[model samples]
Target: MLKLKLYSIICRKYKFVQRESIRSNWMKQRKRTTSATSIANINVH
Candidate 1:
């Protein structure tokens, strides 16, 4: 029973970490795209 509880806790933590990594990656991709678009606008002007 104790082992089952520990396993569940570890699983929860792993899932949380995975979610955080995905969010950070998405944020980075968005930032890159926005910067690229801004640069394009400046070149146009």
Candidate 2:
């Protein structure tokens, strides 16, 4: 019973970490794209 409880807790933590990493990566990509577009707009103007 104790082992099962510990395993579940570990799994939860791992999933949380994975989700956070994915979110950070996505935000970085979005920022890169936005900056690129803004630069292009400035060049056009």
Candidate 3:
């Protein structure tokens, strides 16, 4: 149950980060790079 909760939290956080990344990507491309790195980190871990 605890693991499920953590997973849900991570999913929520990922979505939030994704939306922010998209918004910032319009102004600067750097954010997309960071977002890509974060995705890799998440997938790796």
Candidate 4:
């Protein structure tokens, strides 16, 4: 039973880390896209 509890805790932690990693990667991608669009707009002027 104790081993099962520990396994569940580790699983939850791993899921949390995976979600955070995905979020950070998404933010980085969004920033890059935004900057690229702004540069394109500036070039149009």
CA-lDDT, candidates in order: 0.98, 0.98, 0.89, 0.98
- Superposed model 3: Cα runs more than 4 Å off: 28-45
TM-score winner between candidates 1 and 4: 4
Q: Model 2 off-target regions past 4 Å?
A: 39-45
Residue-level lDDT of model 3, residues 1-45, one tens digit each, is 999999999999999999998877775876767799899999999
Expressed as tens digits, the lDDT of each residue in 1-45 for candidate 4 is 999999999999999999999999999999989899999999999
Q: Name the TM-score of candidate 4.
A: 0.77
Q: Which candidate is the best by TM-score?
A: 4
Q: Show model 4 residue runs off by greater than 4 Å.
A: 39-45
Q: Once model 3 is optimally superposed onto the true structure by TM-score, how far is the C-alpha of residue 33 displaced, in angstroms?
A: 21
List model 2 lDDT by residue over 1-45, tens digit each: 999999999999999999999999999998999899999999999
Scanning candidate 3 in windows of ten residues, the lowest lDDT window is 25-34
Clashing pairs in 1: none
lDDT of 2: 0.98
lDDT comparison, 1 vs 3, better candidate: 1
User: Which pairs clash in model 4?
Assistant: none
Between prediction 2 and prediction 3, which has the larger TM-score?
2
Which residue pairs in model 3 clash with each other?
Answer: none
